[model samples]
Target: MDRMPRWADVILIPLISLILAALLSALVILFIGESPIEAIKLMISGALGSTYGWGYTLYYATNFMFTGLAVSVAFHARMFNIGGEGQALLGGLGVAVVLVYIPWPHWTIALLAATASAAAFGAAWAALPAYLQARRGSHIVITTIMFNFIAAALLNWALVGPMKAPGQEPATVSFPEATNLPTLHDIFGIIGIDWSRAAPANVSLFVAIAACVAVWALIWRTRLGYEIRAFGYSEPAARYAGISPFKIIMVAMLISGGLAGCMAINNVQGEAERLVLNAAEGAGFIGIAVALMGRSHPLGVFLAALLFGFLYQGGAELALWMNIQRELIVVIQALVILFTGALDNMIRMPLEKIFLAARRKSPPPPGPDRKSTSAEAAE
Candidate 1:
């Protein structure tokens, strides 16, 4: 039997962890001579108060959703693909290449082409590291980390040398006007709702939502997902069952990299309209925390991404209006990541014990033959 109920594992544990993180953050704010209550009010108001705030929050959530799903996929196969940063960069390059070189008649076709290009470029970048790990038995973590730097250098060279615009800027020229995506404001305006034009959230938000659904189906409703989870659970047993470890590693990493690359559609094609240096803005690394908090489930990943997005948009608000240092905001975010990810067991163990005790204390239900058993015993 399981130590705890599935619902507790999926929902209760994360909820408790988030509460603890919030309490710790409140303490930190108190120590810094700021009112935690006021700080929280500002966060809620600034990140969720108006359409503008929602726009930014959802925009950030979109990026996190893609990257979180990437980490979740690889993690199912027991592989830590930390090279999302590099993969996302390459994906941006792919987006730039597609949008800059090709002349598409419409935005929809351009969006589809850019997505494919991004996924392909991201997968290609990950292929080498996957090969090294699968064939040579090299550690995936170390290799993927190294590849991040290599990918950065390559992107830098590409931008500055070949793909650079006519000016001194180390970025490609702006994408064609026809390729520009419709913003949330535009979409909502059609439905008779006014949205903030300044907000970056766009059609990619829907794409992110679709990706979540696709991932859930892939991970829970597919044969390959079963093999990946089985391999992660026990590599030796998987091999005995005819599951190929090499295939699992390569396929998982490729999928992970492709998902990571897909983030470019949100930040690059949807928002920026041109790829720039550090375009990823550290969303790739943030994905690790998102995956950890979400428990590597697609639904969990979506919710966790939303939470992180709130923090991001709220943090910016805090800095602008509250005069709170950016570092303090980072500290708050770190504390959240710490409790939710690193100190997860601190919350989980207690919950397990509590549930177990409750289960033990509960009375057993009457059996179908209870009266007959009692009569027989009396006789």
Candidate 2:
């Protein structure tokens, strides 16, 4: 039996952790000669206030959703795919390859081609690392970390050498106008919603939502998901049940890389219209916190992604208007990650104890058929 109710374990723990994180953040802001309440107000107004703010917020959320789902999938197989950064970079390369090389007549076709290429390139990049881990017993954490640097180097060489536009900056030329994605405004305008015309938010937001639903189904409704979860729970038992460790590891990482790679569609195809260095920013690493806080669940990941998205957008506003140091935003994010991931037990253990004590104190329900028991004893 569980020490706490399912609701408490999933909902209460994260809620309390977030509250504690917020309190600690408030204190930090207070110490730094700023009104914590005002800061929060600004954050709300800046991130959720205008259509423009919503656009940026949702854009960041879209990236986080993809990367978070990627990490969550690998996590179910007990593998930490920290190479999302590299995979996303390769995915951008894939987008670039498709957009520059293809002769698609319409945006929809271009989008489809870019998606396939992005996923394939990302999966290819991850295959070697998965092979080493599954076959040679190398640690995935170390291998994936190393791959990040290698990916950076490769991208640098490609951009500065063969792929750079003639006498232009170290980026590919802008994608063909035909390949340009429809922004949120275009989609909403169809329904008369009238979103901001200049917002970078696009159809990719819907893609992120679809990805979330797909992941939920993949992790919970399928036989492959069962095998993955069973292996994660106990590898020895999984092997005894005829599950293949090599297959599980490889399949999990490949799916993870594909999901991570899809983030490039939002940034490169939807927003940037050209692949550039550091296009990923730090979304890949932020995904670690997202997965941790969300407990590797797609629904939780969606909400957690929105929270971080708010922080990113609001932090920019705080730094711009309030003269708050930009690094303070990093500090706040670190505190959230620290509490939700590292100090999780600090909140959970106490709640478990409370629930257990309450359960023990409650009287047992009345016995069934006490008269029958007495008659039987007498007999």
Candidate 3:
């Protein structure tokens, strides 16, 4: 079979992307009259040099992981989802509403309810565009982006007009104690480790990794995942093979939007959480680049999320150290997107040739005709 080697295509693309992103971002740093080496050193020191920094990095990674996974899931079905921010916002709102309204006194039940509520809202949010695309043949990119804006505006109105906390200066209301996600301190006592001191980057990081594992297993081992991949590679081919493109697209969006919903549980579920005006604070848009850089693979998305998380945390440190605008991080991130997007072909050609040559060298299995004739003659 002259099939292209998938692994060869997958591994090299993102590796080349990171290398190019780094080199290009370094150039941008220098062009801005900053020492890229010093900037990067300070960033690494700030992001991973201490326990406190590691905690923040872990927290940042959590957000990236969820958004990245959301974007990647849709991409697997060849659907480009730009609605992560909106979906996540709705998810957060769902949890907030449930936390405020649901009067569960038990801590565990409240937490579970909040998380599940958020996911459900995300599914609903994404369903609109999915329905339009699936049933009415709307362009997903346009519809999803419009919905993202709509979600942001609605969130602002809700926060300021209806859900506003009494006598509070911020736009958000207070969540009940039961709704708060328990910290590591609530569950375990690590010797010499103060879990209470960690940032709001919640325990959702572990959950994200678990989700990644499940996604990997789902895509590689299940029939549904096979259909998704088939659609991604060739929608017409998938339909010709008896797979329903509309159903697959809907499933992909639901799962993708659901992942963003999980981010709401992780980010804005507990105490001091509320809808603080419009916009997803840019997490939704960042997810597009993250998914592209990850090649829409679970493992790739995890690593890409980690790298994006590092840039975010370390870039903040770099800003503080150099007394510069924090927007410098945004510049670096944009460069990453540029390079990562170029990776589709940049890293594929050579590896594809190498793998193809190797495959050609291996002799093919006996054909059915040859096997039948051999057995007949032997008998």
Candidate 4:
């Protein structure tokens, strides 16, 4: 039997973890001689107050959504794919190559091409790690980490040498106007809604939402998802049932890599309109925390990504208005991640015990016993 209701396990534990992290973060802010309440107010106003703020928040969330989904897919196969940063980087390269080399007549066509290219590059980058882990027993975590560094080096070399724009900067040329995607503001304008300011938030936010729906459907409503989850739960049992571990690992990691790579569509094609160095910007690592906090579900991943997005935008505001250091913002983020990920058991175990004890003590539901009822009637 479950120690607690699924609802409590899914929502309450993570909520408490977030509250605890917030308390610790509040103390840190107080220690720095700042008002935590005021800081929070500033953060809220900066990140959620205006449509412009929301635009940036949504933009950041879009990046997290893709990477979080990547992690979630890998988790379903009992694999820890930590190379999202590298995969996303390669995906960006793919987008740049597609946009620059091919002349598409419309944004829709460009978007489709860029997305496929990005997914391919990201999947290809992940294939080797998946192969190594499945065939040679190389740890997925270690291989993915190493691959991140290799990807960075390779991107650097390409950017500066062959793919470099004809300039001192190590970035490709800006994409053509035809390939530029419409921003949220443009979309809203068609419906007679006014977005107050311009933000990098673009059509990719819709794509991210669509991705979430697709992942949920794939994970919960398909035979492949069942096999993947079965493998994740027990490799021995999966093997006994004739499931191929190698195929599961490869497929899961490839899907993960593809999802991670799709983030390039948001940051590169949608926003930057060019491939830039360090574009992934630690979002890959952040995706780990997101996956943990979200419990590797698509819905959870979406919510967690939004929360982190708020943190990123809000932290910027706090730093600008409250004189908080950039490192402190990082510390706050670290606390959230630490509590939600590393210390999850600290919260979960106690909740489980409490729920189990309560369940034990609760009166059992009355049985439909005809004998007992007849006896009572006789008395």
Strongest candidate by TM-score: 4
lDDT of each: 0.86, 0.85, 0.75, 0.87
Point out the higher-scoring one by TM-score: 2 or 4. 4
RMSD in Å for candidate 1, one decimal? Answer: 7.0
lDDT of 3 by residue, 224-274 (tens): 987887887788999999999889989989988988877776677632455
Give per-residue CA lDDT, model 4, range 1-379, as digits (tens): 4456656767898889889978888898999899999989998999999988888889999999999999989988878889999999999999999999999999999999999999999999999999999999999999999999999999999888888899888999999999999998999989998985577889999899999999888877888887888888889999999999999999999999999999999999998999878878888878887887788888889999999888888988887898686466567667767887678789889998988788789864565233312111111
lDDT value, residue 264 of candidate 1: 96
What lDDT score is found at residue 56 in candidate 2? 86
Whole-model alpha-carbon lDDT for candidate 4: 0.87
Q: Which candidate number would show the highest lDDT if scored against the true structure?
A: 4
Ranking by TM-score: 4, 2, 1, 3
Put down candidate 1 lDDT per residue, 1-379, tens digits, no spaces.
Answer: 4556656767787777778778887887788788888888998999999999999999999999999989888888888888898999999999999999999999999999999999999888888999999999899899989989998999899989999999988989999999999999999999999999999999989998999999887776799977888887789999999999999999989999999999999999999899889888888888887887788888888998999899889888888887576556566557667876678778878887887788789853444222212111111
Model 3's alpha-carbon lDDT is: 0.75
For model 3 the local lDDT of residue 334 reads 74
Regarding lDDT, does 1 or 2 come out ahead? Answer: 1
Cα miss at 10, model 3 (Å)?
Answer: 2.9
Question: Can you write out model 2's per-residue Cα lDDT over 1-379, one digit (the tens) per residue?
Answer: 4576656766787788888878888898888899998999998999899888888889999999989988888888889889999999999999999998777799988988998888898888788999999999999999999998898899888888888887668898899999999998898889999787877888888888999999888877899987888888789999999999999999999999998899899999999999888888878877877777787888888998998888888988899888687667677668777887789889988898998889789954454233312111111
